[model samples]
Target: MYTLLIADDERAIREGISRSVSWSDIGIGRVLLAANGKEAYDIIMKERPDIVLTDIIMPVYTGIELVEKVKDTMPQVQFIILSGYNDFAYAQKAIQNEVKQYLLKPCDAESIRKSVQKAVSRIRDIEKKEQFIASMKENVEKLFPQAKEQFFRDLVHGSPNTQNIEAYKELFNVHDGPYRMLLFRIDDNDYVKLLTLKSLVERNFGEENVTFCIIINTAVVLLTTLTGFHELSGLVEKTQKQCYANFNIEATVAVSSEGCISNAAQMYKEIRDIIRFEFYLGEGRIITKDDISVFRNDYSLDTGIQTEELSAAIRTGNIDSVKSITNCVFNAYRMKGYDINRIRACGIELFIIVLKHCEDCEINAWIKNITRINECNTASEIKQFILDFAVKLAERTYQSVISSQNRVIEKVIRYVHENLDDENLSLQHIASDILYLNVDYLGKLFKKETGMRFSQYLLKVRMEKAKELIKASSGDIKVYEIANATGFSNNPSYFTQVFKKYTGCVPKEFRETGKQEEKDSGWLPL
Candidate 1:
């Protein structure tokens, strides 16, 4: 909907035009009346109406003067001139003011409506153009982040088009001078916080001087035309302090060696290496290549013994022993004043051992734990990481042992059930001949698993089978046949004695009774 303003010194003419024009039919939802040119100008300035109709001559200000005053700021507003005189001078002045329509003083409602229709058409066209521009701007805003990230990725990988370097600098509005890349590895891996930090940095350093991009998990800041290392360092420090103050996140920043736009890829690589070294340098600190140059000694530590002992304790599920070993190793490094790289190397070795152990035990979901290990930045953090890894490793190992024991026990029980009728199905035969296990150890394991001696279990199995055969036979099979069928050899009397002891009934009596009611009653017949 559009607003229309009518200005005429005559009140009746203004009200007649406003009432008879049917503004809604002409696509004007509002019709504002202004008594004179000055009132109309005030209304236009305040409301910014879509269409204006004014007489060429009025009391406070002339219509030409109003149009001239507001044409620059209200270029989108459409205008129509109503004049008592049809002189060439008035027509020429209306043309100069770019009025959309001109009408004589005695014009009827039809002429005014036609003029408003034309003004509405022009407003619609203007609105459509504005909408298209806004849509294009929105699309560009959405694509900018992705484009920036891709550009940084290509630059860092040394894959950006060499021919387009100057074009890119101009397009991105980056100055051509010495640049430095600062790579930040945030400990929390919070992209939102990283973005906030990026905004803070852009605000501290001018937005034109800095460009922020996130490559994989790290946030990259390219400082354009940075004056000196000290200035870059100061900016980084300010960013860190602000980030902590605002978001409570700790970030470690690694600055690259100075270079120009063409050297961005190489500088990125250098700074990236330093950022990776942050695993040892700890968090919430700014690092540079120069800071690492002093600690460039050939420092090496033999971690074989520590690794062995830690692995042994983990295998044994000894949490205390593992913690002791981990603390000792880290403390020793701390006392010896080992460089961060050496300490990191040791930490990596220890982590690999745990991972290998987990792999050996078929525990493959330790990626999150490994990530924590990689993020550790201090001796205490490293120690805690090792301890936590050891604890989980111990739990998984214990569960693995229990699972293996259950599987072995199930196999043993299945074997016993399948061979219940074999006469030579003793523990020795089952352990050594069939299952490939030591006889004595298998016997002890079976007893521990089933809470009974091997012989007792075998006797119980045989006696149960003898009773089943005897009852199912209905006297068709004799006692001797039952005994032999139940892996009891040729001893009918012995089978009866064993059945009597097990079920409190002789074999013949159990078969004749056709039920074991006396068994539940604890009846023992000699």
Candidate 2:
């Protein structure tokens, strides 16, 4: 919607133009009327109408003077001049003022409507251009941070073109000279704390000198024009202290070796690799490349035996032995003053071993625990984590072993029932020859599970089958056939002896009176 203002000294002219003109049809929502130039100027200042119509000659001030005064401030406001005379001087003055249209006194409604329609169209065009510029600005602001982060990431990853480096530096307004990369490992993922830390760093080191971004849960700070490591270290320390004080966050910062912008990528990688040594350096401390270089000597961490011992202990479900082996490995690392990187590397290797062992035991829960390997800040913490993890692995492994043993026992019982007539279904045949398990272990497991020795259980099973066969045959089947069917080796005399011991009767007598005796003895059918 648009507004229109009509100014003329004549009451009839002002009222006539306001009433006669179909302003609403021409996109003008309101029509403002004024008696003179002074009144019109006041309304223009207050209302800022989109279009204005004023007489060339007016009281107190002329239309020319009104336009000249307000033109500079309200450049978007359109003006149309009205005059009784066709004076070339007034036409020249209106042209100088950039008035949209000029008309004589008896202008028709069609002429007035046409002028307003043109003015409304110009206003809409100007507004559209302004809106487009505003939208572009909003999009640029949103993408600026992402662009800056990408630029730094490319610089560090050795992918940025050196030819365009200066152009990008100018774009981001980075200063020339000594710059260092500081990688801080933040243990918390709270976005609020991350943002708070970022703001504090920016505030301490002027926003232009520092560019920070979160990469893989770690904050990377690019420091420009840093005087020396001393100054950078102090600023990082203060920032760390402030974060702890304000947000209750603990962080460990690693400073890369200082160099010019050209080496920034290498510096970033170096610091990233150095920070992994925090497992030995402890958190809430600043570690620099120089700090760890002194400890980086050719020292071999012979963890082969220790790892094997730990693996063996875990296999046997010995929690105490697993903890002892873990402690010894870490103690040797501490006592020998091994390189932090080597220590971390060995810890990772040990974790992998544990992971593989867990997989062999079919324990899947330990797989997720691998992520915590990087969270340890000291050798003791790493030891403790490994101990706790090994304990869980051992428990699951033990349960798995028990479950496997039970399955074997069940298979053996099934084989015994299926092969009772073979006369070769002894414990040795099942454990050594068929199942290929340790004979002694299988015997103990079978006895412990069934609460009877293997031979005793076998005898009980054979005798029970014999009783079923006797009842099922109803004296039609011979006693020798029953003995052969029940793994008695076709020996009727021996079968009768065992059957008498089991049922307190000979097979023939039992077969003859077994049905009547079953009712008195409360013996249920198999």
Candidate 3:
């Protein structure tokens, strides 16, 4: 639907056109009548009618002049010229004012309708084009930020593009000057909290001065000139405090050295590399180029004898030795400021070494400690876990070692008692044939466990068995039988010598003394 305005100096002409034309058929919703061009111009301004039909000659303003005034203000308003004279000048003036429809006077009702319809058609076309342009502009506005973010990311990671940098800056609305990259490493992985932190940082530093993207964590491409490079330290510190107080997060900021927009890739690389030092510097810190320069070249891990030393300590079940070696390893890493991954790997290596030496202990604690070690963000935390783990492992190993040595000594003693009649029962036979252990190691271990050498323990057991056999036997029991029964095969005299030395009497005399003692206490022996 469209609004149509009819204007003429003659009241009849204006009223006749409004009445004769079936305005609705011509897509005219309302027909406004103006007696002169001045009145029509006023109506056009006020009503903003879609189409205007006016005569060339009017009392106040000419139709041509009205067209000229309205066209500048509302180019979308289509104009139709009505002239009483067949004059080329009037038609020429209509054409000059961009009036598409020119109708001479005495035109019929059908002709006026056709001309108004043509104006309506032209108006519809103009509206469609305008609508398309508005829609396109709306979509572009929505996508503009995303495109700008991608451009910033490309500029940060890709090769330097100094050639068209100015045009790019204009396109992306980036201020031209020195730039720096700030990477925030958030301890928490909650994305919503991360975004909140980003918003907080952007608020502290104006949004236009920084472009942010979340890659692993938040990365900020700061326009140093816009933010004032000298003021960055104070702003970063303020943001850090806010992050702690508001978000309760430990966000460590790694800042690159001052650089141009062209070398943003270098700046990003520098900041990323600087962030890795947080493992040594501890978290929730503002690390800058100057802060890390001294240790930048000192990244090699000291993988010398520390691992071997720690392993040996754990094996020996020495808690103090284990702790000392653990301290040495961690101190070396802290001094060199090794890469965090390398340090983690070293920690894992020590964990494996501990696991290797462990037997019959709670393994889950060590496995959980591996995760704890990996999750530790700072050197001190990892060192503490390793130290505690090593110490506990040493204690467990010590208990296991003691329990195992007791069990082996018990087996050796049981074997000697079980095989005493063999007369070949010896520590060497027990170690090699029964227990399958090194003779020297078993000997020293036996003495340490029982306060007696294996051989001495064996002799004591044999002599005790001999005395028991002789005393428990009847008086008819032979000495040789008693000797053979007590592991002295076919050598009663030698057994007697050993038995006499053990009990201060020969075997026969010992038996006779026992009988005599029984006779003295009672009337007869059973």
Candidate 4:
């Protein structure tokens, strides 16, 4: 439903319009009324109503003045002027302004309803176009970040077509530089807030003398033959003020380390270098070429003592400490505008450091499952992986309780395989193999890893051995005799039950079906 505004100086006209029209029936739900042109303009700016029905002459400002003030800003708004004096001059002025219609005051409800319906239809069409663009962009985002950035760039830079005209760039602080680039930012977006930001810059900073293409949702590139740095600063500084005053937005502008020739793509990369300053300067703000500087120093993830301490922690899975260090590293780079690929590469580098001091076995295999594919394609992806693994590994390791369980997991797996025939074995059998861990605690670990009771694995193993004995023999044998030898204790009836579960048949039937006696070889799964 579209929003409708009724503005007039006369109380009777306002009340009559409100009471006479079935606005809800015409797809307008919210109705705002203003007593003067100034008040109506305030509503139009704030609420951005689809239709405005206003009296031609009002106390503070006339409908003509209202149209003059707001039409350029909101050109799509449909306006119908109302007047008590049906003078030819008033109608001609309204027609010149392209007002939808000039109605004699106290017009019938049917006349107003027709205008309202037409306005709603126009709004619906605009909404459909917006929805289609949003959906198409949404699908493209899921493919990859690089693809998403390229799509945004192509959208703004590509030609509109032979049948269409393109809007000119509106430069604010930009000057006559040899090359120009735009930095677009969508605020508060976990998703494509970037797109909104890009759109805003195109509106505020575009110009005919300059040609620009969006490089990503968050930035654009413009190139021109004009030259002058002072003029450039003037343009950016002014654009900054208008953005906040007009749109309630704050976006950062980054000047390239050096301006490029009038090549759009090359100029884009040159400007992109300034993005590195986003870390030191921060996001949601601008950093220009002057803001960035170079040094002869080189630094890796490790910085002397910090590296030493962090590497040691990662080696032993002293995860809480590792988490603290990982945070420092990721935050430093992420603030620099590095994407996930850079982040994950840092993660891999840290892992390598950890690997230097510790065995692969010391590192949790579960972490390998999580980093799953640590192939770093971009800075952002890598950074994200590091951030994710750093936190989770910390939780798994230094949550303080799991460390003992880790050892117990390893020890029990070794013990179970070594003494498979000992169905009499219990958690107590594990105490000597892994020192300093309790029997009850050991039972928990055994179950967590092997997914069976400690006693259950032993029983399964004995049954497995019994199956082989039955199949290997050419001579007849009873199940009880085989059960006692394979450590079934003294329960003959239970042994046959356990054997049936493992082999999916009664022992006698299983032995008979395997009449190609020599063919029944190993007891493992096929």
* Tens digit per residue, CA lDDT, model 3, 310-331: 8888887888898877888888
lDDT of every model, 2 decimals: 0.76, 0.78, 0.76, 0.63
lDDT of 1 at 246: 81
Q: How many backbone clashes does candidate 2 have?
A: 0
Candidate 2: pairs in clash: none
The CA lDDT at 97 in model 4 is: 80
Per-model clash counts, in order, read 0, 0, 0, 38
Identify the candidate with maximal TM-score: 3
lDDT of 2 by residue, 342-431 (tens): 666667656767765655334345646665766766777777777787888888777888898799989999999999997767999998
When summed lDDT is taken over every stretch of 10 residues in candidate 2, the lowest stretch is 517-526
On lDDT, the candidate that comes out on top is 2
Worst 10 residues of 3 by lDDT: 517-526
lDDT for model 4 comes to 0.63
Ranking by TM-score: 3, 2, 1, 4
**Candidate 2 wrong stretches, greater than 4 Å:** 84-92, 158-171, 186-209, 220-225, 239-250, 260-263, 279-284, 294-526
Evaluation by lDDT, superior candidate among 2 and 4: 2
lDDT of model 2 at position 179: 70
Superior by TM-score: candidate 1 or candidate 4: 1
